[model samples]
Each structure stands twice: as C-alpha cells, then as structure tokens.
Target: MTEPNTESTTALDHVHRARLYKLASLAFDRPDEELEEALVSGTFADQLLESAAALENDDLEEHARAVVEASPTDAAGVDELYSDWSSLFGFETGGDIRQYQIEYSPGTLVTSGDTLADIAGFYRAFGLSIAEGNRERADHLCIELEFLSHLALQTAYLENEGDETGVAVVTDAQGDFLEDHLGRWIGSFRETVAEEVDVEFYRALGALVDTLVGDDTDRFGAEPKTFEETPPSPLEGLNDGEGDFRCGTCGPTSSGSTPEMPMGDRDGPY
Candidate 1:
C-alpha cells in the first residue's frame, strides 16, 4: 500500500487574505500614526504575529482580502494621503506598483498595455498576488507580500497552538523573499519616497518598511549592505551652482583642490 502523506496542507482563506489586503491598503491610505496603531492594536496585528509564531496558513487568503478591503477605506478620511500615494505609486512614477500590476495582475500579467485604470483594475483583480512575479520589480512585491504572509501564518499557528512545520515554512518563505529580493531594493525605494515626497503617510510607511526589513534581516541572519551615510549638507552654505559638500569654512573652495595642511613641524619633531 502507498504511504499516506502526513503533512498538513493549509491554504489561505478569505479572512486571512482580507487582513493582508487591508494592511497594504491602510499602508497607502492612512497617516503613519493611524497605520501604526492599527498594526499594533487591531486584529490584523494580532493574527499576523500569532500566525508567524505558529506557522499556519489556514484562512490566510481571508486575511489577505481583509487587508485589501480595509486598506482604501481606512484612509478615506485623508485625501492628501491618497494624493501622495498616487504620486509615489501610480503608473507615471515608474515605481513598483506600476511594474507589479504589469507583471502579476491576473489577465494583465501576460498582456501588454499601460493605463492608470488598467493598473487599478489589475490590483482589484489580483489583490496581493500581484506581487508574485519572478522579475526584479515582482521580486520587491513578493518581499512585501511575503512579509504580510509570514505575519498571517504566524498568527494562524499561534491561535491553533504551536505548529513547528508551519512556523518553519512561514519563516523560510519570509527569509527567502527578503534575502533574495525586497531587501535588495527597498532601501533605495524608501530613500526615494523620503527625499521626493512630502506626505507623512509615505514617510512613515517608508520608516516602517525599513524597520521590517531590518527585523527580517536579523531574523534570517542576513548581512545588509551599507550605503554611504552622507549627512545632509547645510542648506545655508549652498550658493549659486555650488554643490552641498563645498567647504563652507574656506570660501568657494575649488571642488578639485585639496585643502592645505596646518603648518606643524611634525616631520622634524616626530
């Protein structure tokens, strides 16, 4: 007789999908404070962490759906939030959302065309699965989705009691997504949003993304790349055609000139 498979199979359900979809929507919809509060205090937060701790995928689809539905509505009160989001994530920006919808959104994934409505429809159709492509941009979306998926899975495991296999799978998926994709470009994306946009929601969301990326890296024993940490140049020191780093102490210091060293007789004394 053939051996029966003993491993449990857990597919994502409506509640779970809703939860993740709502979280993403909220990330784009509300202000940072509101989003933060929801993530910490709401059922979304509870279920995510719980599932990660336990590693269950039951009802994960439902959680993802909840995230989608709750997202756009939660931020309805703040028009500015959507405006900034549109600027940052819309089709014109050449950002991930545009690329994501192009590559993974159900019917649109394989077909070719560009339009705002088309992209929005794609999001509506595929919801969170829009991030599943193997391309670079798709990889980023995958990372974001994996993060949410891990939280959902963790919540499921916790609620149903500890399940090692489920937790391992969730953690493995999260680690793979991060180490392979989102971790690679999210920092640049966050910097772009922080530098180019004025919206508090995006800024806060960027910070949250940074935090989550860091946390995931630490969790998976991945070493992050160190970008140049140049401090913001003083605005007052800037002049016509001058770059921010031009030395202010020495007026109009030539960009190519090396400053003269102090006339200490160290060569003779030392």
Candidate 2:
C-alpha cells in the first residue's frame, strides 16, 4: 500500500498491491525453507524491492533494499532466521509480543472477546472462515494480512470489470478493516517486533509492514486511534499454548492450502 504512482486502477497497480500483501503475509508468519529459497534466489525480495523502488516513498525503498541485501544466501542463514522467529513469536520464549489483533486492539484489557467476534464477523461476511483445523484465531496477524490480499484481489477484479460501485464497496471495507483493526495496533506491533527480534530479516519485515500500514492509513484517511492512557499489558493467555508455529502457506503441506480463502466471483455483502 505504498502510495501508488496513480490510483489503484491500472493492472500494474493491482499486481503490486497483491504482491505487497503476499509478501507481508509471509513476512509476519514463521519462516521455512521455501521462503528461504525465495529470499535467497531474489524471487521474493527482488519483486518486493523493485515495487518499493517504483514507489515515491523513499523510506520504503530503503527498507526494501536493506531486506534484499541482508537476505540469507544459504541454509545456515535461513536457520538463523527460523531460530529468531521462534524466539520472537513462540510461547516458550517469554516474549511479550502478541500477534493476535484483539490483544493489541483492546484499550485497557489485553483479552479477547467482542473484538475477536466482530473480526470473525467481517471474515464470515466475505465467505471466509479459518480453514478447518487452523488453530490461529481470525484476528491473527497472518490471517489479517491474507484477508487484505483477498480484498486487494477483489478490488482488482472490480476495477477490471469497470464495476465502480463494487470497487467503492470493497475499498470502503478495506479502510474500515484497517481503521478498526490492523491500523490501530500495527505501529506498536512494529516497534515491539523490531525491538525484540535480533535478525535483520524480521527487522526489515517490521519496517515493511509499518510502511505499508502508514501508507494505507494516509490513502484512506483512516485515523488510527491513539493510546491515550497506558497500553494494555500483554495477556499471558494469548501465547500460552501457541506451540511451534509454522508458515501455513509456505510450510510443507500434506493436503490443502492454508487458512487463506479465495474470493473469485462470489458476491458477498461487503
């Protein structure tokens, strides 16, 4: 969502947005060998950095460049990222960071309740539910990013079909989703992750996600709520049983896809 050269109307713009979401989704999730290969071969980093370079955002371009330069070139380097990922996001690491949106969205209480239900309502309205057996909640960072990917794709489709009304509806939903959920907490999340992680890979990711969310906020004029009082403490229950997380999308898959849901031609009440 780095401010596009033009409005998100062109085919190239749609493709760029899609790529941004996909990369962000992978970045926030646990690292694996497939992702390592993509990074080392420059397949993922090159595309992302190239897109950022095209943007007018200099900070984004710089972070993307750093990510490309610091990318692991061998299995050992990838293993280092995996280890860092575990320490940063795992339950056993005594980490204060929580990836679920509800944990961060709350003002004083760091527990899940209505906020989680409302987030699930948004997904269900779009015919999306966590894939069966996917233990991650609807508000998990990776799930939210993947949902944005679907929204971007839907916007692209509407644009292609010249459905201005549909585009506006989806665009409004995007802004609403950001304002209510991701935008509200991503700044704090980015700061926490950057402070907690030791590896450059995650640092770059924090920068990238921060940049994108900032741009999205500006584009949509979505004012993120401020933490007037002290932010809530990290809820121990949020990470209590989050055992050995893996990238559902990029990890070794024995059957179907991840918790990702595709929005083809199905009409939903956006």
Candidate 3:
C-alpha cells in the first residue's frame, strides 16, 4: 500500500533513499560495536522513523521503531546480540542466514554465470563497484538493496534536472531489477531469516523485507521469473552412469578426469 511519493522536488526524497540504503547496507555488513551503540542511542532509529514518515509508509515506520525499542539496553546485552548477529550471518557457528540472491532464488546456483554478470554490469553502468575488501558478490542481498537505494537517489536527481527520459529510465530499471532479482527471492529469504534468528530486532527486519518486496511487486505488477522448473544440474545427472557426460559449464567429465568443480568454487565473472 505504501508507495514512493515522487512529486516533491526537495531533500525529502534524498533522505528517504539514504535511509533505505542504510537499512539495506546493515543487512549485509557485519554488525559492530558502533552499530549496537547507534541502535541503543536512538539516533539510528530516529533517522529511520523520520524517513519512513516522510515517505508515508506507516508499516516501515513501525518496524524501524520496533527494532530500536527491542535493542539491548546494556553493553553486555549488545554484545550478546552482536554474537547473535555473527551466528546468524557470519560463519561463526555455521550461520544459515544466506545474504545472496542466488542462494535463495529457485533454480539458481551459487555461481550462476549470466545472472551475476548482468547484475555486475548494472553496477558498473552506474559507476559502482564492490569494495576491494568486500567478501560478498555483487548480487549479494545487501549489495542489491544498496543498488536499489542508488536507483532511487538517481531517480530523484533525474527528476530535479527535469530530465523526463532519465527519470523514466531509472524508474524502469528499478522495476526490472526488483522483478528479475530481489522480488523473486526476497519472500523466501525473509522467511529464512525469521526462522533462523530469535532476536526480535532481526525478526522485525525480516518482516520489513517481506513487506517491502510484496508492496513493490504489487505496485509494479511485477511477475517475477521463476526458474523452479529448470533442469537438474549436470553434476546431479553425472552419477547416473547412463553415458558419457561433458559439462558445458565446467569441462569434460568422462570417468577418469577430476570431478566437475562446483559452480561457486571457481572464479566468478567479476
């Protein structure tokens, strides 16, 4: 029900895009002491709530407020929550909270070639690049969300310049990106996060993600492409012993050669 108000030509839209970017960035980046402090101190919550209010998204405002309200009050509590963050996102205790779109999307492998390349191309077209030290791929959920924020900010700029063509382009890009990438997997991903983490703050975030994706999908009439019916992987059929199997993705695998490597274990398009 909540939609972006693009009628304004002021700083309001910029502020909204910034808040969305911050929220998305937090989803991927490791939670640190500073982040905990920000949550407990109410500064981050205020900014989030203000942005949500400006956008007239009451659900988002409530969710943002709830995260701050549920934040740990003491230092030890914050540390515990930080540990929860690690256990849920980091590989601290074999974390199951996957932050990549490919991992969540049906029929998508960790090393999906064209999908990753296309996403990276979009980033480069916008003058964005993954940080050198960043461990995640360009299609990582956090990166994708940040890209959405970038698109929104860019849309505002185009609007300011009265460049109708540019505004339409940016708008179309947002819809396409969401439908093709995030929208397809976000619902399942949100459910996974909520199921994995017991922290109320994180659960609230999961709810927010679910709602945002659902809202946008409906708003744009985005019929996301589902690859659920995609054929089995070559590796899956290799053990059948029916006949010779040559993997087009990797190389030859005719009994004596090394087993075909996993898709993600090799170098990415980036």
Candidate 4:
C-alpha cells in the first residue's frame, strides 16, 4: 500500500532513485567482477537499504532487506549466485529467461517495428549509449533500467542547478519511457526471473524491480499493459530507420548485427 511520494521532488530522492535503478541494471547484467565485489563486500546491500529508505517506501525497504539477506557474503556464495544468474539469463550459459521487452511484446513484427527505434531515441536524446562490452540490446531490461537511471540522475542534477525546464523534461521522459517500455513488462519479467533462477537473491531482486517499477508507474500515472505471454521472436522486419539496431539478446535479426549499437546523435533538449 506504500505509494510513491509524488511530492518527494527533493534532489536526494532523485539520487536515491537513480542509484536504485543503476543497481538493478548491474544486478541483472551478466555478473562481472565489479558486481562480484559489490555483492561479497556488502556495499550492494548497504546501498539498497540507503536508497529504499531515502524513497520512504516501505515495500522497497522490505524488498531491499530481502535482497540483502539473500545476497552472497563470500566468494563461494558469489560464485554460486553468478552461476545461477548465468543459467537464468547468460548467453554463454544458454540463459533462457527473456530479458528483452520485444520478447514479451505480442503481435506481428510490423506492429512492433518501431519499438527498438523508440527506445533508442530516448537513449540518444539523453546522450547515453550502451557500452561496447555490453552483450544485450537497448530493449534489454538492464539497458532500459540504466536509461531510467540516467534520467533520474539528470533530474537530480537539473534540480540542483535550479533548471526547471531541464527537470521537467527529464522527469517526463522517465514516466513516458517507463510507460512504453520497462513499466509495461517488468512485473511479468520479474516473475519469470524468480521462477527461472535457483537463488533466493535473484528472486528478491525480481521482487524489488517489480515493486520499484510499480511505484513509479503509479507516481507517473502511467498505465502500462502487462504481457500475458511471451510470443515467439519476430525480429526480421523490425527496422530502426538507419539499420543501426537489431534484436540480439532475446533473438537475433537476420543481419547478424546487434541492437547494442550506439544511440546516434540527436540535437536539442529532451
């Protein structure tokens, strides 16, 4: 019953929100050494608590605690958690969970043709791009979360600078992007993550994303439609205008290139 505090426009809240999104992005990605250190060192847990508390959301605090409790506190535990992560979502380990929004989207390719383009547009407009080492596409859950994290962090900066116009643009972008992308399918994806992974940590993280996104959905007055079932990949005809993007993580396009492509330059404030 803990709703998002709509009046909570403090820079600190925005910072906390950004940190939470960044943490979620890193948590869901292929477990790298940085993530391993955060997990074993308990920095991950500490930050989760700090952010959840900053948001003043009871659900987030509870889920954050669950994640903390379930997190690995040692090297062997981290190894076990990473192994489970790889099994559930890693390409090298035949990760089966659909972490991309397009995978959860229904209808034919034409209907969803602009999905990739739209997501990339947001990233490009904000001057953010997927890292070269990334294995997933822009439509991937982690990337979308990271994009939101960027927006939230920007909101804090803009607010601190007293740039009202900038704050408005960034916050509106966050709500719209979530409504169109992450908010729409996050709950379903979270459930799948919990069901597919063996570790309690992943389950807790899934719950955390579901709650965090749900809170934002409410705060933004966004009514994103949840997917009932994951349909087969329809990546062939999907175009990003420049042939710069392709579905690679959930499924590959005929071109063999991936949607990990950079968000091309887009001018103006947005």
Candidate 5:
C-alpha cells in the first residue's frame, strides 16, 4: 500500500481529491447544456456527495451536501445560475471577482513573465498542456484547479503502480504549487466569492473548494501568504505599457462534461 505523507497524499485520498477539484473546475466553467443536464438531473450533486463521502471528511461531506441541496431543478434555476456566474466570473471589465492568480499578488508577480513561465513549466513537466479551446490564461482559477486535479490523479496512478518515488515527486510538486500559487490566494478568492456573490449555490461552491484546498494545504504543512484585495492594478498608471503574463503554450489538454463522474478536463498528461 502507498503511504500517505505531507509530500504526497495517500492513493485513495488523491482519487477523491481529484474528483472534488475537477467538479469545482467544471462548476466554474461556462454554464452549458451538459452541465445543466447534470445539475438538473442531480448527477452532479450525487457525484459530489460520493466523492466528498469517499474522502471521509466530515466538513467536506457537509459542504458537499450543501452543494447537493443547492442544485437547480429546472431551466429557470439554471438561468439564474448562469446569471450569477456571469456577474461574478464573466468577461466584463473591472468585474468585482478576479479569478486569475496574478490579480492578488502585491509585487510584479502580477505581470511578471517569470511567474507565468514557472506555472507553465509545471504543466509542461507533467505533459499537461492547456486545451486549444481554453482561452483562459495559465493563472486563471479554473485552470489552476484543474491542474491540481490532474496532479492528484497522477499521484494516485503512480502510487497504484507502487512507484513511491513518483508519488513523492508529484506530491512534493503539489505542495510547492499550492504554497506558491493556489493556497496563497484561494482564501482571498473564497472571501471575495462569499462577499460578492448573491446566490446560495455559488457561495456553497466557494466554500467547498476553499475547504478542500484548505485541508490539503494543512496536510502539506504549507502556510501560504493570503491576499486581501481583488481588483485593479496597484501599478495601474506607474507601469502603463506592461501587459499581463502569457505563456503562449496551448496543446492537448482535457475538458469535457459527462453525467455520472463529471470528468471535465482542460489539461491532462500527454
């Protein structure tokens, strides 16, 4: 059996965590017919409950139940869901909610090409590339969450094959990635989501992803520096010409929505 450590979580745990992360990514994606069908039919919620239950964490299970109970039952409810999604996560300029990682950083981490390159490096190292159709940046929330999900799934695969070294490498990467990226700002993201979002379903979602990532952050003993603000550049006029970081790499990645498991992918190991 593969041992669970901070550097790497257990195989079974990784499986559940992967599903949880993927589900959160799918939820945040552009609301579509496939997603609506899953939500309306209750399969999304059911799979959520199963994954949360599989993890055997009371808090995750509780929040997962909240998500399940908060599902939309009809088209109108789905429309409302879409409205909230656009209001908080749409393409509108100067939107209240910011999903990109660079938005929360204090220093040049905002527009720093190095940070973006490092993020893309993580993906490339694992044979995971951005989907050709995914217009979102490497630092976008959904992309980052899906990246973690891919890493977690990979960890499980390595562990099942008794590749202890592989497990350690992947787990260590997860820890470092969180400490440097997601864990640092997701708390702030969650706070923003809670404070700005009106709908119960999204609020529940914010809480769920926050809690799941929090648990893993604890497991890795990573204390990421959280940000408080979520808007326009502090260096707006001071550095006018600099553009946001872009890795310019988009290749075979995963992204699709199904009824039962919701294995929506924007990146997968190639």
Candidate 6:
C-alpha cells in the first residue's frame, strides 16, 4: 500500500473519517451513479459499495453488531471477531486465486428462514472472500477505511465521555493490519472475484472494487486504471442523433430510462 504523503496529519484524519462515513452512507442508500462513483474511488468504497449493493436483510443485524464491537481499544475482541470470521469463511492460502473457488460457494438470500445470526454469517463469508485474493494494494485501502470508521466511532464515544484510549488503540491496530496484511492482496482478489464469480452481486462487487482502488490511488498521487479506459460500452453507438434512443434488449423504446431486463432472462445466478 502507498504510504500517505506528508500532508497535514489532522486534515488527512478528517478526510479519512469523512470518506468512511460517506462509504457507510452510500452502502445504505445504494444510489446508482453515486454508488458507481464510490466503487471507482478506493478499496474501501469498493468493498462497501459491493457489500451494500449485494446486502440482504439477513446481514444487517450482524453489520450492526460488527459496528458496535469494532472499538479502538478491544484487541482481543477484534481478534475474536477475525477468528470467528476466518473459521466460518475459510481464509485464502497458497495465493492461488483459483483456491477461493473451492472455498466459497455462491448462495442466495433466503428471507423466509433467515435469522440475524445467519445474516451475520453471510456477511462474514462475504468479507472473508474479499480478503482472500491477496491484492496488497487493495487490502491496504480497505484496512485504512475500516480503521477510519472505527476511529470515527471511537472519537464519538470519547466525546460522550466514554472510554476513548482503548478505542484509539484498536484503531491503530486496525491501521497496522490494513497496512501489513489485507492491503497487500485485495486488488488481485477483487479482480479474481470479478472474473471467476458467476453471481451478479459478486460481479458488480468486482466492478466496485476496481473503481474504489482506482479512485483512492488517484487521490494518493498514483495514476490507476479506470473502467472507462477499458473496452467499448455496450451502449456505445446505440444512441441516436436525438435524445430519444431505442433499447437493444427490448427493442424500440422512447427516450427515457431503459427498463431492466427480466431477472428470469438472465443466464447467470440471480
């Protein structure tokens, strides 16, 4: 991961916190263009956008728990969370992206039989799979995001006269983890997920991951590649001279928002 340059430490801290909150907000709201922008911005934005886009009700309770438990001071508690996640989600080994295929099977959200515990498990698996691919740069960005979020929350707690020092410690630990471990392999992992995963959520996630990494690097003085610089859009050359355009999928529609294709018509996992 690129080291943050010698900027105003406090300013950087504020930017980091703002970015974290923005990511959290985007995850909840799921706006189309803004979500796309967030994904193209950084690793944190990528993870949050994909996670949010694919989020099901089953995972909300667990996310809430994680938010509460992720304090700056609780190293043991944080380790426990990581351990539980690894056991359930199977950490990546051998650095072979293909290995992840055998570990994570694609599953759907089942609202009927879902419990809060089950939902949390799903998120654990999802997050772990993201970390498996070993893209160091991407992992670093994600770690920073997580650390910033924890710090912001802890700062809030401190302002309220709650324990702040421990929270700060946890934030430091999380930052170290981001810098040392996860940041190393997240980009490659995301790419592998995008290429290998058959699920729509995962594919979109890969896109988001790409976007975020690219955006963050740009912010930090690195010129990262973007999706727009890649292959021609499917919508390219399809636009007519006027504002009105036809739909390639459904044929001959007026100039308005194109309708989504029926889910049943899609070839891959829904």
lDDT of each: 0.45, 0.73, 0.69, 0.81, 0.81, 0.38
Instruction: List, residue by residue over 1-270, the lDDT tens digit for candidate 1.
Output: 112121342433323532443454456532466665564455545654443233243333333333333333343534555455566676544433331322322233334344334323433432443445533433334335444554545545643666676655554544544454455556665676668766554555455445455544555555545333434445645554543454444433234434665333423311
State the lDDT of candidate 6 residue by residue for 1-270, as single tens digits.
344331333333434444544564343221245444433344443444344333222343234234322321234533443343333223432222332211122222232234223323332432433356645322123334443354445544453464556544433433443333323344555666556544333344344443443333433434322212124445657667553374535433345454675343433322
Residue-level error in angstroms, candidate 1, position 124? 19
Note the residue pairs that clash in candidate 4: none
Model 4: lDDT to the true structure: 0.81
Q: State the weakest 10-residue window (summed lDDT) of model 1.
A: 1-10
Candidate 4 lDDT over residue span 15-54, tens digit each: 9999999999888887789898998888998998999988
Alpha-carbon runs more than 4 Å astray in model 3: 1-11, 73-75, 108-111, 218-221, 225-270
TM-score of each model, in listed order: 0.43, 0.77, 0.74, 0.80, 0.79, 0.28
Ranking by TM-score: 4, 5, 2, 3, 1, 6
**Candidate 2's error at 70, in angstroms?**
2.4
Q: Is candidate 1 or candidate 2 better by lDDT?
A: 2
Scored by Cα lDDT, where does model 6 land? 0.38
Model 3, total clashes: 0
The residue-by-residue lDDT of candidate 3 on 32-142, one tens digit each, is: 766767666766677767776675667866776776677666778778877888888878777778888777654556558888998898888789998898878877887
lDDT of 2 by residue, 1-270 (tens): 332222644645655766787887886677876688787787887788777765557888888887777777777877887777777786767656688766655453344577888788879878898888889878889898888878878887888898988877777777788888888888877887788767777788778877987776776667768433245345644543664333333433245554665333223311
List runs of model 6 lying over 4 Å from the truth: 1-148, 155-175, 210-270
Residue 146 miss distance in model 6 (angstroms): 5.9
lDDT sort, best first: 4, 5, 2, 3, 1, 6
Query: Where in model 1 is the C-alpha error above 4 Å?
Result: 1-25, 29-77, 92-143, 150-160, 224-270
